[model samples]
Target: MDFKTEFKPLTVQPQEIEGKSFEIITEELGEHPFTEQQYPVVQRIIHASADFELGRSLVFHKDAIEAGIKSIREGRTVVADVQMIQAGVSKERLERFGGGIKVYISDPDVMEEAKRLNTTRAIISMRKAIKEADGGIYAIGNAPTALLELIRLVKEGQARPGLIIGMPVGFVSAAESKDELRKLDIPFITNIGRKGGSTIVVSAINAISIMATALK
Candidate 1:
């Protein structure tokens, strides 16, 4: 069979392509469990990672989106457990609101503390982030230990984050950490199973940032 092997050039703006992608994602997700406001956050997650399972796996506290939006609009710092999560976030979008992303896992002090405590750097970093960015948003997408640390600090009355995006992916305590987060009285966005990553966390923040921009 004779076939043309030439590639065709596309003539669509980046924004248009993104808009269409989101449109297709929404259609594919059809009738998810999220509310109208919450659906946007879920959609953004799916858009970022192209993981439609998020539609089913994602779980949100009733006020998670509201809390996230408030924090983003107020320019609250975004504290990430790992550098990957921090790097994946859209800095330009966050900067518009005078907010920025931070990751302490690679800090010298965090390394020293981790060595002394015999724990992961993520856990030590979270402790420092809690003290430095109190009332900010905590996005823990790589280490379950970090999520656990945040929960412990909050319970001990040492940390009070505006919102917690706990979607750590792993075979270890990822699912368990999310369970603990669900029990907290504070607002949070997490998933049901062990299927989450930096992309999911970044998407959640980007979604909130976009929504907040619309309000301004």
Candidate 2:
């Protein structure tokens, strides 16, 4: 039996395709609580994930958009939970503002420390990052332990990040980690449940950076 059918894309151009996709997402998503500045990040997340539910589940601090934009424009350093997120962010735009991204999960020092302490590298990486990237954006996606450690750092008053994008994906502690992030009274962008990943984090960072660039 042959179950083949013909399907064609509406547009071959990348920008057109993205534009059309955003239009559909906006039309189908309908009313939402996101503000004018925050909606673009939500829209890009749905565009990247094609999951309206995840997009709608996003919770933002009142200062999230402004804080994220300020960090980018200020050329503050960005720390990612893993290499995938570091690779996915737009380094070009970031460099234009003297900003940059760093991922320390693979660093030799973090690795050695984690092994010595019987802790995950994700946890150690955040520990290292906070010291070096104060007032920076922390983008966590893929490691629940990292997000938990960052939350701990925040509670202890050891971390003063400009914005925290904590959306690690997993069955163990992923959702719980975000719940803890919500308890803090700092600027953050997070979501409900364990439905998050590096791609969505990159989408969010890119959207915020794009907005930041427009201001320049």
Candidate 3:
């Protein structure tokens, strides 16, 4: 027996794709705990990953979205934990407001410092990045060490980022790092368990950037 194949390509306007994606995501995700303001972040994450589990895993502070949007609107720089996260972000969107994406993991100074301190390059990179962009957005998606260092810096009153997007994906300390981030008395976006990565982190920032553009 032979059956005819039926395949239909999605024919939607460029602007309508995002709206349609959100509609489908919401429909599949059912009821989400995020408020209207926070929904965009969640929708973007699911939109990037096609994983509805993020709807339940993602946790946002009461003022997380508000602070993130404020930072984006102010043209604050984005400091990423790794190059992949930086590459994944929408540079055109960020540049619209005079902001830029920075990743210091590959810097020679960071490598030397990491070697001397016997720590991961991500930690040293975070230290350097925070100095360059004091009140920027911190997007940590690949390295738990970077997230931990950021928390330590914040506690020491050395680093003061406007918002933290902690979504590092790993088996070793990923969950623990997010737990520590949640305890900070600052604006942050994170998810429970071990389901996160550079893609979701970039998605979160892109969502905030898009929202900022709309607000302008």
Candidate 4:
């Protein structure tokens, strides 16, 4: 099918989020993207990847999950908590669950700050965050250094495995993080390309939360 990509800008509404649906926040982009024509195909791909969350700004939600599970079935979900990735060394280890592996990237703005900080402080903070996560949700954030640190961690470990989700909210850094994860041959998904905000990250998480709730 010839699917056209839309470029509608969106705003995120945090308080309005519920169950698995988010308020329509793509008004800024107009009828460019997220229209009926594009939602299905985009929904299909996300479903293939087992991503079924919705956002107040953009992305798919609960309805998308039901549609998605019908097609793709054989993957794991990883939740990269906002803090875990920011922390540095011992972030959560959902991959430790031992399955197809899915990753959820958190807020990207936070990482941008870390990236610009002093090298020593940045490393120290990251390391602390990792230790705190110990295998929890932690997005690589928008900081290239943070993503690079994650790459280093993976390379040095040689035992970690699963999908990587880098939701950086910047131009170069977000793209770079996604590239790094791709290089590792780790299946990944991200809103970095759109300069996504925290809402996008939350939307991705909401997708996984659907399955999580279902399994319960």
Candidate 5:
């Protein structure tokens, strides 16, 4: 989606100013796919066409969810059981969230395994659901040039997204992508160091899910 309208000018504001509306650049929302309201203020503007009653919905894959739970019940800590989110890493809760371990995807074989094992699929599916409601997920996968090209496209009046989730894990280009994402000032949840993998992505998703529930 190309944004042709420029409201005032793109100047960063320290706080929301009353009566001052900022232009929200986002992709076209045909059929709302988001279930949970990620950003209330922005949703009102960008998702104006969407029905609030049916904002976004989440239907966790039962098998996947169960597997994650069973892993923890069996006392396995070698790998992260990121199915049920226990608590926030930054928060002291009823239970410690993860095993304090990090995973990274740097090999093609591992990436292929992640896809086959349904980890990658789960993350992609969740993201696609969000994209359906607003725009597409903006971030560098394993390609920094592609991300810059995408930004160029949006800047050059080709395409744009309402939100961008920069969740790239590990690669020779991960640092470059992270830098570009920071420069773009996109909203995202990321792990420290090279922590992009099937487990890591799911863990991040679980973390957000827990946060959403906690807010309620």
Candidate 6:
């Protein structure tokens, strides 16, 4: 005996499928605390991972939404902790706002410096990143060390990014790093726990970039 089910999707059009998905997401995730501006970003995050808990766990600074939008519209650089994030974001949308993604973790110079300092490439790459893009939006999804280093830079008045989207996934310091990020007055978007990844970061950035395109 063979058990097989024949099924067809509700819609074959991409736009309609996305619209149906958003409707389902909204219907299930009712009465969220996020504002009109913040909800879209949260929606994209959930859409990317299909994790309601992760979507609900999102936290935002007072200026986070507007700051992220402004950064993209102003053509500031966007920094990512890993190549996965760099690859996941919509480059065409980001570049439409004159912004571009930068990832330094694999750069030879950053690698060499990390080895010399006996540190993770994440830590050194951040040091280099701040110099190149002072007001960039940082997307850190896979490296807690990178988030910590950027937080340290913020505390020391050495770096001033427009926004930091930090949700590094791990059991070690991911939650702790997000806690530290919230303490700062700077603009940032983060989650409450270790349940984050490159997809979350990419979704957040893509949402913001899409919003920014309205101004262009």
Using lDDT as the measure, the top candidate is 2
Per-candidate Cα lDDT values, in order, are: 0.89, 0.94, 0.90, 0.41, 0.35, 0.93
Model 5 CA RMSD to the hidden true structure, in angstroms: 17.8
lDDT of 3 by residue, 1-216 (tens): 996658655754766987788889988888767899988889989998998886579999888888988888888999998888888899998888899989999999999999998999999998998778879899999899999999999999999989999999989999999999999989999999788999999999999998888985
Q: lDDT value for candidate 1?
A: 0.89
Q: Model 6, 27-144: lDDT tens per residue?
A: 9999999999999999999999999999999999989999999999888999999999998999998787688999999999999999999999999999999998879799999999
lDDT of 1 by residue, 6-82 (tens): 86658447888888988999888888778888888888888888888765799888888899988988888999988
lDDT of 2 by residue, 1-216 (tens): 986658765667898889999999999999999999999999999999999999999999999999999999999999999899988999999999999999999999999999999999999999999888878899999999999899889889999989999999989999999999999899999999999999999999999999999995
Model 3 lDDT, full chain set: 0.90
The TM-score between candidate 6 and the true structure equals 0.94
The collision pairs in model 3 are none
Ranking by lDDT: 2, 6, 3, 1, 4, 5
* Candidate 3 segments exceeding 4 Å error: 1-17
TM-scores, all candidates, are 0.93, 0.95, 0.92, 0.45, 0.32, 0.94
Collision pairs in model 2: none
* Lowest-sum lDDT 10-residue window in model 3: 3-12
List the lowest-lDDT window of 10 residues for candidate 5: 78-87
Cα RMSD (angstroms) for every candidate in the order listed = 4.0, 4.2, 4.4, 13.3, 17.8, 3.9
Stretches of model 6 off by over 4 angstroms after superposition: 1-10
Error of 6 at 101 (Å): 0.5
Per-residue error (Å), model 2, residue 164: 0.2
Worst 10 residues of 2 by lDDT: 3-12
TM-score of model 5 vs. true structure: 0.32
Model 4 CA lDDT for position 70: 24
